[model samples]
Target chain A: MRGAVLHAPGDVRVEQLEDPRVVEPTDAVVRASATCVCGSDLWPYRGINEVTEPTPIGHEYCGIVEEVGSDVTTVRPGQFVIVPFIASDGTCAHCRAGYQSACAHRVGVTGAQAELLRVPHADGTLVATPEVPSAELLPSLLTLSDVMATGWFAAVAAGVQPGMTVAVVGDGAVGLLGVLSAAQLGAERIIAMSRHEPRQRLATGFGATDIVTERGDEGVARIRDLTDGVGADAVLECVGTGESMDQAIRSTRPGGGVGFVGVPHGVEITGRQLFSTMVRLHGGPAPVRRFLPDLIDRVWSGTIDPGRVFDLTLPLDQAAEGYRAMDERRAVKALLTP
Target chain B: MRGAVLHAPGDVRVEQLEDPRVVEPTDAVVRASATCVCGSDLWPYRGINEVTEPTPIGHEYCGIVEEVGSDVTTVRPGQFVIVPFIASDGTCAHCRAGYQSACAHRVGVTGAQAELLRVPHADGTLVATPEVPSAELLPSLLTLSDVMATGWFAAVAAGVQPGMTVAVVGDGAVGLLGVLSAAQLGAERIIAMSRHEPRQRLATGFGATDIVTERGDEGVARIRDLTDGVGADAVLECVGTGESMDQAIRSTRPGGGVGFVGVPHGVEITGRQLFSTMVRLHGGPAPVRRFLPDLIDRVWSGTIDPGRVFDLTLPLDQAAEGYRAMDERRAVKALLTP
Candidate 1:
C-alpha cells in the first residue's frame, strides 16, 4: 500500500507502506477512494508541530469498506462510507449525549491519504450511504467526513437561527463550508471574512450574503458596520490564532455566541472582556460522526457541493504537491485520489 | 435624600445627596423601603477596584413608586416594585428576545442604596407586586432585585436539568443563592464549593447536595471523584478571577455548560483548551428584569428566602458598618433600612 508519510518537518512523501489490517474486533479496513490535505495538516508540515518520525498523515476520506472485524455490525464489506475523523464506540455515555468526539472509547484514524486505512470502532464511526456515490460527488462526500461536518458543528454550536446575522472568520474550506451550514440552518445573513479571490468566490457560492476582506480589528469593524454597529448574532472562528479569536469575539453582538472550530495555537480569552461583552463561547473538536450521515446524503443529492473547495487535485503518488499547493496558499483545498 | 457613597476605596458613608428626580419621560422615582449591599459592591471597597471619587453605590433595592414621568405607563406611583439593576426599555429587539440586560436603550440605575432612586425605562425595568408585603418578607423580596435573579440566570444559562449534577464555584450570597436556583431548576445533585462554615451551612440549606472545600485543582479532583471522574453536567461560576475561571472550566464535563455570573477580573480562556474540552461558556450581567416577576412571587409565597443571606443589618446611617462587615468577611450580605 502507498500512503503519504511525514518523515520530518517540511518533508512529506508518498511511498509504499505496510497495508493496514483490522487489528481489533471493531475495526474495518477501508480502501480509500478519495482523500484531501487539511489545513490542520499544515501545522506539522510547516514545522510548527514536532514530527518525531515518518507518520501516517491524513484523517479525512470517503471509501469502500474492504474488510470488517467480527464486531462490526452497521457497516459491511464493499459498502461506501464516510468515516468521521474521530472514531467512537457510539454507545458510550458521551456519544449518547451527542458528543462523539469525546466518546469514552475513541480512536483517531490517521493516514487516510493512502490506498487503504484501518478504521476503529467501525459501527459507530462510519456512516454508510445507500450506494457508492458518483465520482463527481465523491470529493464532496469525502469532505463530509471532516471539514463539512466541522463547519456544520460550528454553525450549530453558535446557535445560528433564521433571520440572524452570522460571521465566519477563516477563509479555508471549513470556513467556506460554514457559510453553507449557516444558510442551511436558516441564517438570513452570512458574512464571510476573506481576502482571497478563490475562497471569496467559493464562500459566495456557498450562500454568504456579505463579504469583508479585512482582518482583525478592521474585519470586526466591518462586520459591526454591516450589523448596524451591533456585531453579528453569531460568529464562527475557524482560524485558531490570537488575531482570529479576537476578531471572532469582537465581531459577536452582546449576548451573542462565538463558535470556534480552529485548532488553537496561542490564543487566550480575557475574563473581563468575556463577561463584559456577554458572549457565549462554544467549540472544540466537532462531533463529526453526528453529521456524517446527513451530510453524505446532502452531498449525494447535490444539495451542497463542498468539493468545489478542491481547486487542485493529484494522484496519491503526488500527495506532496497537494500539501505544497495548500501550504503556499495556491489552492483552497487539494484532493488526492488513491 | 441620603445615599451610600464611596468617597474612595475603603471609605463608604451614608451622606446627603441630591434627591433623585425623573430625567426621562419614561423614568420613575421610587422611595426605597429596603436596599442591600451586594457582593460586587465590596470589589471597590476592598480595593480590588479603584474608586476615583464619591461614587453613588449599590444596585439592589425594593421600593414604593414615588412618581412616574409622563411616558411611564406600566408602573405608577404608590405601587410597590422591585427594580432590576439594568433598566431596559422592553421594546428593543434584544429585549424582545429576553436579553433585557442588553436592551438597546438600557441604562444603569445608580444610587439604588438611597432613600429615593430614579429608575430609567420604568415600564420595562420595574415589576410590581400585587400588594405591599409584610415586614418579614421584605428582605427576601428585595433580593429578587439582583442577587436572586442573577443566581437564577446562572442556573438557566448553565441549562441545569433534572437528575443532572451541578457545581457552583463561589460561595458568596449569589453562589449560595445559585444552589437554590439550581434546586428550583430541578438539578438533582448540587455541589457547592466552599471552605467557610457559614457559607457551607447556607448552601446546604439552599439545597446543595454536596460541599467541597478544596480550591482549584484539588476542588476539580474532588468534583470529578464525586461524579465518577466525568465532572459535573453544569457548573455555575460566580467568582470572576483566573483561579475561579480555571476551576470552573476544569470541573465541567466535556460537552457540559458553564454559566458564569461574576464580573470577570483577570481571567483568560485559551482557545486550545476550550476547543479540546468541548465545553460551552455562557454568561454576562444577569437579565434580572426578565425574572423579577416570578422571583417576586416565589419570595412572597415563602418558597425561597434569599434574604437568609443577609446575616447582618443596620440602619441607613450605619452604611459604613455594612461595608466594613462585608469587606472583612464577617457577613455574606448586609441589609439596610431607611
Candidate 2:
C-alpha cells in the first residue's frame, strides 16, 4: 500500500508502506475513497509541533470497508463509511454523553492519506452512509470525519440559537464551515472576520450576513458596532492562537458563549479576564463522531455544500503538493484522491 | 445615620454618618431591616484587598423603602425590598438577558450596614416581597441580597439538572447555599468539599448527599471515585483562589460544566489545559437581581432556609464584632440588625 509520511519539517512524501490489516477483533481495514490535508496537519509540517519520527499522518477519510474482524457487528465489508478522526467505544460514559472525542477507550485514526487504513473500534467509530455515495459526494462526506463536524460542534458549544448574532474568527476551512453551521442553526446574522477577499466571498456564500476585514481589537469593535455595542450573542473561535481566542471572547455579549474548536497553540486566559466578561466558554477537539450521521445526511440531501471548501485536489501520488498548497496559503483545503 | 466603616485592615467601626437620601431620580432610600457581613467582606478585613481609607462597608441588605425618587416606580415607600449587591437598569441588554451584574449602566451598592441606604435604579435593583414578613424570616430574606442568590447562580451557571451529580467546592456561606441550590435544582447527588465539621454538617442539611474532606488532587480523586470515575456532571466553584478553580475544573467530567462564582484572585488557566479537559466554564459576579423574585418566594414559602449559614447575629452598633467573628473564622457568616 502507498501512504503519506512526514519525514521532517516541510517534507512529506508518498512511499510504499506495509498494507494495513484488521489486527484486532474490533478493527477493520478500509480502502480510502478520499482524504484531505487538515490545517492542524501544518503544525508539525511547519516545525511547530515536534516531528519525532517519520509518522503516519492524516486523520480524516471516507472509505469503503474491505474487511472486518470477527467481533465487528455494526458494520461489515463493502459498505461506504465515514471514519471519524477519533475512535471511541460508543458505550463509554463520555461517548454515551455525546462527547466521543473524550471516549474512555479512544484511538486516533492515522495514515488515512493512504490506500488502506486500519481502524480500531470500527463498530463504534465508523458511520455507514445510507448507501454508497457517488464520487462527487466524497469531499463533503470526508469532511464529516473532522472539519465540518468540528464547525458544527463549535456552533452547538457556543449555544448559537435562532435569532442570534454570531461572530466567527479565522478564515480556514473550519471557520468558513462554522459560518455555514451557524446559519444552519438559524443564527439571524453571522459576522465573518477575514482579511482575504476569496475567503470573505466563501464566508458570504456560507450565509455570513456581514464580513469584517479588520482583525484583533478592530475586529472585536466591528462586531460590537454591528451588534449595537452588545457584542455577538455567540462567537466561534476557529483559530487556536492567543489573538484569535481573545478576539472571540471579547466579541461576545455578557452571558453569551464562545465555542473554541481550534487546537490551541499559545493561548493563555486569566480567570479574572474570563470572569469579568461573564462569557461562557466551551470547546475542544470536536466530538466529530457524534455529528457524522446527521452531517452526512445534510451533504447527501444537498442541504449544504461543504465540499466547496476543497479548492484544490491532488492525486494520491502527488500528496506532497497538497501539503504545499495549504502551507503556502494557496488553497483553503486540498482534497486527495486515493 | 450610623454605618460601619473600614478604617483600615482589621479595624472596622460603627460611626455616625449623614443620612442617605434619594439622589438619582431613579433612586430610593431604604430603612435597613437587616444587612450582613459577606465572605468578600473578609477579603478587605483580612488585608488581602487594600483599604486605603475609611470606606463604608457591606453590600448586602434587605429593608423597607423609606422614600422613592420621582422616577422610582416598581419599589415605593414602605414596601419591603431585597437590594441586590449590584444595581442595574433592567432595560439594559445585559439585564434584559438576565445578566444584571453586567448591566450596561451598573452601580455597586455600598454602606448597606447603615440605618438608611440609598439605592440607584430602584425599579431594577430591588425586588419587593409580597408583604412585610415576620421577624424570623429576615435572615433568609436578607440572603437573597447576595450569598443565597450567588449560590443559586453557581448551580445554574454550571447547568445543574435533575438526576445529575453535582459538586460544590467551597464551604463558606455561598458554598453551603450552593448545596441547597443544587438540591433545589433536583441534582440526584450533591458532594460538598469541606474540612470544617460545622460547615459539613450545614452542607449535609442543605441536601449534600456526600462530604469529602480532602483538598486539591486528593479532593478531585475522591469526587471521581464518588461518581464512578466519570467526575461530577456539574461542579460549582465557590472559592476564587487559583487552587480552588483548578480543582473545580479538574473535578468536572469531560463535557461537564464548572460554574465559578468566587471572584478569581490569582487564577490562571492555560488553553491547553481547558482544551484537553473539554470542561465548560461560565461564571461572574452573581446577577442576584435576576433571581430575587423566585428566591424570595422560596424563602417566603419555607422551601429553603439559606439563613442557617449565618452563625452569629449582632446589633448594628457592633458591626465591628460581626467583622471580627467572620475574619477569625469563628462564624460562618454574621447578620447585623439595625
Candidate 3:
C-alpha cells in the first residue's frame, strides 16, 4: 500500500507501506476511494505542532470496505462507507449525547492517505451509503468524513437558525462549507470574511450574501457595520487562531452564538472578554460520525455539493504535491485518488 | 440623604449625601424600602478590584417611586418598583433581544444604599409590582434587583431543561437561587458544590439533591463520580474565578453547557483548555431587567423565597458593619434598612 508520511516539518512523502487489516473484531479495513489534505494537517507541516517522528498522516477518507472484523455488524465488504475522522463506541454516554468525537472509547483514524486504512468501532463509526454512486459523487461523500461534517457542526454549535445573520471567519474549505451549512440551516444573511479572491468567490457561490476583505479587528468592524451595529446573530469560527476566534466573538451579538470548529492554535480567551461579549461559545473536534448519515443522504439527494471545495486533485503518487499545493495556498483543498 | 460610601478598600462609611432627584427625562427617584450588600461589592471592599476615591456604592434596591421625570411612563410616583442593577433603554437591539445588561444605553445603578436612588431609563429599568407588599416580601422582592435575577440568568444561560442533571457552583446567594431556579426549570437532579454547612443547608432548602464538599480537581472528580462519570448537563457558574470556571467547565458533559454569571477577577482561559472541554459556555452580567417582571411575580406569588439568603440585618447607619460582615464571610448576605 502507498501512504503519505510526514518525515519532518514541510516534508511529506508517499511511499510503500504495510497495508492495514482488521486486527480487532470491531475494526474494518477500508480501501479508500479518495482522501484529502485537511487544514489541521498544516499544523505540523508549518512546524506549529511538533513532528517528532515519521508519522503516517491523513484522517479524512471515504471508500468501499474491503474487509471487516467478525464483530462488525453494520458494515460489510463491498459496501461504500464514510469513516469518521475519529472512531467512537456508539453506546458511550457522550456518543449517545451526539458528541461522538468525545466518546469514552474513541480512536483516531490515521494514515487514511494510504490505499487501505483500518477503522475501529466499525459499526459505530462507519456509515454506509445506499449502494455505490457514480464516480462524481465520491468527492462529496468523502468530505462527510470530516470537513463537511465539521462545517455543519460549526453552524449547528453556533445555533444557526432561520432568520439569523451569520458571519464566518476563515476562507478555508471548512469555512466555505460553513457558509453552505448556514444557508442550509436557513440563515437570513451570510457574511464571509476573506481576503483572497478565489475563496471569496467560492464563499459567495456557497451562499455568502456578503464578503469583507479584512482580518482581525478590522474584520470585526466590517461585520458589525454590515449588521446594523448589532453584530451577527451567529458566527462560525472556522479558523482556530486567536485572531480569528477574537474576530468571531466580537462579530456576534450579545445573545448570539459562536460555533468554532477550528482546532485551536495559540488562542487564549480571558474570562472578562467572553463574559463581556455575552456570546455563547461552543466548539470542538466535531462529532462527524453523528452527521454522517444525514450528510450522506443530502449528498445522495443532490441537495448540496460540498465537493466543489476540492480545487486541486492528485494521484496517490503525488501526495507530496497535494500537501505543497494546499500549504502554499495554491489550492483550497487537495483531493487524492487511490 | 444618608448613603453608603467607600472611602477606600475595606472602608465603607454611612454619610449624609445630597438627596437624589430625577436628573434625566427617563429618570425616576425611588425612596428605598430595603437594600442589600452583594458578593460583587466584596471585590472592591476586599481590594481585589481597586477602589479609587469616595464613591457611593450599592446597586440592589426595592423601593417606592418618589418622583419621575416627564419621560418616565412605565413607572410613576407612589408606585413600588424593583430597580434592576443596571438601568437600560428597552428599545435597544440587545435589550429587545432580552440581554438588557448589554443594552446600548445601559446605565449602572449606584447609591442604592442611600435613602433615595436616581434610576435612569426608568421605563425600562423599573418593573412595578401589582401593589405594595408587606415588609416580609421586601427581602425577596429586593433580590429581584440583582442576586436572584443573576441566578436565574445563570440557569437560563445554561439552558436548564426539564429532567436534565444540573450543577450549581458557588454557594452564595446567586448559586443558592440558581438551585431554586433550576428546580423551577424542572431539573431532575441538582448538585450543589459547597463546603460551608450554612450555605449547604440553604442550597438543599433551595432544592439541591446532592452536595459536593470538595474544590478544584477533587470537586470535579466528585461531580463526575456522582453523575456516573458523565458530568452534569448544565452547570451554573455563580463564582467567577479561574478555579471555579475550570471546575464548571470540567464538570459538564461534552454536550453540556456552563452558565457563568460571576464577575471575573483575573481569570484567563487558554484556547486549548476550552477547546478540549467541548462544553458550551454562556454567561455575563445578568440581564436582570429582562427577568425582573417574572422574578418579581415568582417572589410575589410565594413560588420562591430568595430572601432567605440574607442571613443578617442591620439599620442603614450600620452599613459599615454590613459590608464588614459580608466581606469576612460572617454573613451570606446582609440586609440594610432605614
The C-alpha local distance difference test score for the whole of candidate 1 amounts to 0.90
Per-prediction TM-score, chain B alone: 0.98, 0.99, 0.99
C-alpha DockQ of every model? 0.77, 0.89, 0.88
Query: How far off is each candidate at the interface, as Cα RMSD in Å?
Result: 1.3, 0.6, 0.7
Q: What is the per-residue lDDT of model 1 for residues A38-69, given as tens digits with 9 covering 90 to 100?
A: 99999999999899888989999889999999
Candidate 3 C-alpha lDDT tens digits along A81-198: 9989999999999999999999999999888898999999999999999998789999999999999999999999999999999999999999999999999999999999888999
Backbone clash total, candidate 2: 0
On DockQ, who's better, 2 or 3?
A: 2
lDDT tens string, model 1, B61-152? 89899999999899888999999999899988678767899888889866888899999889988999989888898889888888999999
Give the CA lDDT, 0 to 100, for residue B200 in model 2.
Answer: 95
Off by over 4 Å in 2: none
lDDT pick, better of 1 and 3: 3
**Native-vs-model 3 lDDT?**
0.93
Quality of candidate 3 docking, DockQ? 0.88
Candidates, ranked, DockQ: 2, 3, 1
Query: How well does candidate 1 reproduce the true complex, by DockQ?
Result: 0.77
Greater-DockQ candidate between 1 and 2: 2
How large a fraction of the reference contact set does each model reproduce? 0.83, 0.81, 0.85
What's the distance in Å from true for residue A104, model 2? 0.5
Q: By DockQ, who's the top model here?
A: 2
- lDDT measured at residue A265 in model 2 versus the true structure, 0 to 100: 95
